[model samples]
Target chain A: MNPTLGMYRPRNTPMHQAPAWFKAVLLVVIAAVFVLFTDPITSVGLMAACVLLLISTGPPLKATAQGLLGIVIIAALSGGFHVWRGEIDRAIDLAADLVGLVALALAVTSSTPMEHMLDLVSRILRPLRRVIPPETMGLMFAITVRAVPEVARMMSESRSAAKARGLDRSFRAVLIPTTTRTVGFALDLGQALHARGIAEEGDNPAPYRRARRVKH
Target chain B: MIEFLDAEFTAPDSGARILEPTTLTLDERRISIIGANGSGKSTLARMINGLATPTSGSVRVDGMDTVKQGAKVRRVVGFLFTEPSSQLIMPTAIEDITLSLRRSIKDRTEREAAAMQILGDIGLADKADVSVNALSGGQRQMLALAGVLAITPRIIVADEPTTLLDLRWRAHVGALLRSLPLQVIEITHDLEAAARAQRTIVVDHGAVVFDGDPAEAVEYYRALMLDRAVGEPAT
Candidate 1:
């Protein structure tokens, strides 16, 4: 599966130009509809529509298919489980529903930049600004998204380090280093955030004030 | 100008000295700090931007107290880390730079354009939308620098920024840092790079053991290392 499947791919398609909040709402509504519909043919048709929508976003079809491989495996396993229970029609509907939902979700994610999503989130949560700063939540979301590949890289590095030391078979050997590295990464990230003046904007600069005006 | 007015740092829990009391005014366009590991070089550099506050005396950048005016100080100072991955908070190059401009540029399209412009200047224009994970170590460091530059800071404090890079990337990043039109205080183990600075300070045992010409500071640090090696028992 493609590690970068959900990450925005630069494109000039209509999907890319659509507002992030609109796509988010559409994704939610479509997901709800997919769950409500139990017919195999309808589910398969919806899955095809999702696939078409994803293709229209202009990302490489081969790469997109590769990214959906893990989902396909999960859907197949689920279908097999349902078939074992003597529910052939239910198996097809469930498998199609899973694939369709994942595709639609990917369509939204691949076309929308993370910053736009954060902006949408900040607007949604702006009312709760007193209790929880939307900017802090946005930072948390960005960091969590950023850490996905980093954790994957660290895990591989830890595994390699274990293998080099002839401890490849030991799960503890790999886990320890990976966990330590993750904690260290988090600390460094916090320090970087501090250095960048994030969460410390008491006396906002002229450009910042002007920018806030522009944003509003 | 950055001033360390008899500033000192002590471990909060252990009450051990991390940086000994010292006073220095730094106004040079390029100043390098060199020291052994755990010798308080990072502590000194970090204080300039208020990442680490002094335990007793105060540190000021252009007369703004680092502790009291931390946010203001941070605005004037941009910091670069040894590990670029740590500094990068976004998945893509353009997005990371845009994140840096989040405060300064409110308009989304204009901010993205500004980020793209920075990427082009840094020769990462083609990789603007590429995932940062796909970048080379050198390119990642360059992107990290781009993120720092997005704020248009007056001073930059880099703590071992090139220590993680290969020889080629090290030279590239070192040259880039030198060419930047701002005050730079770098903490590095690279004696050659240290010598390129206008002035150099040597830290040892949590004290500024030597502060003068870059060449002389390097020589003093080398001699100090040799002296320590000769005096210590062999492991």
Candidate 2:
């Protein structure tokens, strides 16, 4: 099984021990600053600061490098577009903005456990418990976070299944089974929720109605 | 007792009959159901918890109608799916079990404590906070079991729980299932595991063709498969 992206490393460092809310707030502030300030000059400074923060995390070098490689691929295309337009300055600044955000997010993710992140999300959504089950929101986040790597695993399995059947070159052969299995996964999830008593009535915890009541 | 009275299933898309009408009262502590793929055994097992509600008639657990009292029925009838990864919804081990305890325990610390105890039970105490993605197949299955057991259901309906496991994990999970004090209804293709059950039911072409001792049911299933393999219609 593939480890989720930016896995949390259980460490005793100050950043690792920081409250999830604090990191979340910091992430929001970073986002807000980027949104509010459009100047390329400021973005370059922001990028440099994010790099320092990333280094301070003492990340697993391999994962960070792999993450950066992916980031560079996307940023390179966009940066090339800007450079070709004769806006070299804009190209540099845009790359900084892109890399800065990813580095910040990665640093935060590496420091905080997903449980803490979900708890923070649950607490934030507490006020909405009246209209939506707040805890269910956190569960939704957990499921989504868990599903990504699982989806990747399923894709690989589907690919293997296709190769065994000599249909490796056909996209439809892969897509059909992957899609079906994913749908089955979702259906099974509902049954698991119901069996766990998570979908009880008035549980309104996210508008999920229980399985249809059998008529007499 | 988990009872099915005239319970049946019909696939909506193909309008194909998935399970024929059947009636039985099952109260055995360890019951096994065996059938070939697409034989409707999973459908029959799922009916106990309303996962596959009968298209006609009804299923009841301990006098509680599965459909009318589904929430209550579910609270007492734990279900373990074949895929541990699909069932382990939370990000971490303790978190998944804690989520299971959410309805039963309100206090966060207390809930987590109980979850830790459960992980300890399954020997995953050290991995309590580890990402579920990092778990091996056996560990993941154990975690899934911990979540289901955390609910303390009176009866457990397992739908091919060991299908995805390796030889070691199969025996490990099989022993874990057998050791539970609760009543268990397991659907499996493993004849050896089926033989451990007090009773077994064999399903074929969406019908319960045999309901008797596990040994006999296993023989019946083997014969049925042999017939199909030889291009002869099953009797």
Candidate 3:
């Protein structure tokens, strides 16, 4: 079966037992640190740390490699560009940073339940209710994350559809339907939300000033 | 009760009337709408909860105006669409139900508990944390229905809810839908299901052609289709 996006994989690791919010915040801090670092030796250290962290989560290493395949390819191409520019050390550093960042992200995602993560986010954003509804934003964030897989599926399907009729050479025919279907999906999604009466945020901007204190 | 007071609907794109002016008072616990594709039955059903607002008139649910009190009206009416995928927006089943309960239950712990109870009611407690994309079609549809029912809406408006399921799943889904305690307004192609409703409505060419007992209404619709079949020249 295809791996679920940002879904919890029931594991009894220490990371799995860690608070979802803590892991979420930690991932962001880790990403920022990786972005700031520049040296290959330091980045290699970071990559080793991330690998140890990922190993603690106890998922199969082969599965991790498969999940990180895209990251590997991109990192290779990016690192190769640095080497082509006569910066071999820089190439290794860049690849290490990329790989470390993605590994940490995957580790965090696999450890925490997505809903727990989103709920914590919603609570943290509650004070900004006057500017925007925190709950709605949380829902949007989850939807956006889930949409990545949906969009990916659509892309593969579009390629196969184009190849079926030997219209693979025609970008117009393939791109048009892919783009059109994405828009259609949005429209259908909007209608579905409306039907479910979950369009509460967009219709009412910010009336949080008048909101009464309710028990959480 | 859901009431349509001379409601009319015009297609925004075509600028043509899809639902002619119609007046109805729906108080039945179970009412089914039967019609051919694009025959305005969905347009009528949507008006109840303000999914499709009346172009010229008004729709009221238990005296609450659907347009003026759109949000409030929506709180009372839950909708189930033909395609379940659109309804399962969250990655996992529990999360989707939790989303439904966000308005009602503010506490995250309480909301999760409530969602779990709803899932258990729908026989999906074991699959709570499982991604919805991984579920079978019948399970997905059941989860979608569970999401709607989680909020405890007063009425459920299902537009061809079983159209996408295979025979067994279709029967299973239809039975599950019929067994709901709340008032249900279903628009469907299944005459057998339609036959079980307290009342049935028939729409044709964007208008209500028949409304009465389920047996008579289904008979009228079948006869109308048969007549059209014989009257029209073979292609």
Which one is best on lDDT? 1
lDDT of 3 by residue, A1-216 (tens): 134633567799999999987888888887777778877788899988987887788766775777778788999999999999999988998899888988887788778766776778677887786787776777787777667766666667788899998988888777888888787777777777776777363333447423521221
Model number with the top TM-score: 3
User: Model 2: what TM-score?
Assistant: 0.90
CA RMSD of all predictions? 4.4, 3.1, 3.8
Output the better candidate (1/3) by TM-score: 3
Q: For all candidates, what are the clash counts? A: 0, 0, 0
How does model 1 fare in lDDT? 0.89
Expressed as tens digits, the lDDT of each residue in B1-235 for candidate 1 is: 9999999999888999999998999999999999999999999999999989999899999999998778789999999999898898888999999988988899999999999999999899999989998899999999999999898999999999999999999999999999999999999999999999999999999999999999999999999999988999878
Considering DockQ, where higher is better, how would the candidates rank from best to worst? 2, 1, 3
Instruction: Report every candidate's CA lDDT.
Output: 0.89, 0.84, 0.83
Ranking according to TM-score, highest score first: 3, 1, 2
DockQ of each: 0.47, 0.54, 0.42
Q: Record all residue pairs in model 3 with backbone atoms less than 3 Å apart, i.e. clashing.
A: none
Better of 1 and 2 by DockQ: 2
Question: For residues B53-130, what per-residue lDDT tens digits would candidate 3 score against the true structure?
Answer: 888889999899888777788889999988887778888889889888877787888998999999898788999878
Candidate 1: residue B146 lDDT (0-100): 90
TM-score of chain A of each: 0.82, 0.80, 0.85
Output the lDDT of residue A31, model 2: 74
Assign candidate 2 its CAPRI class: medium
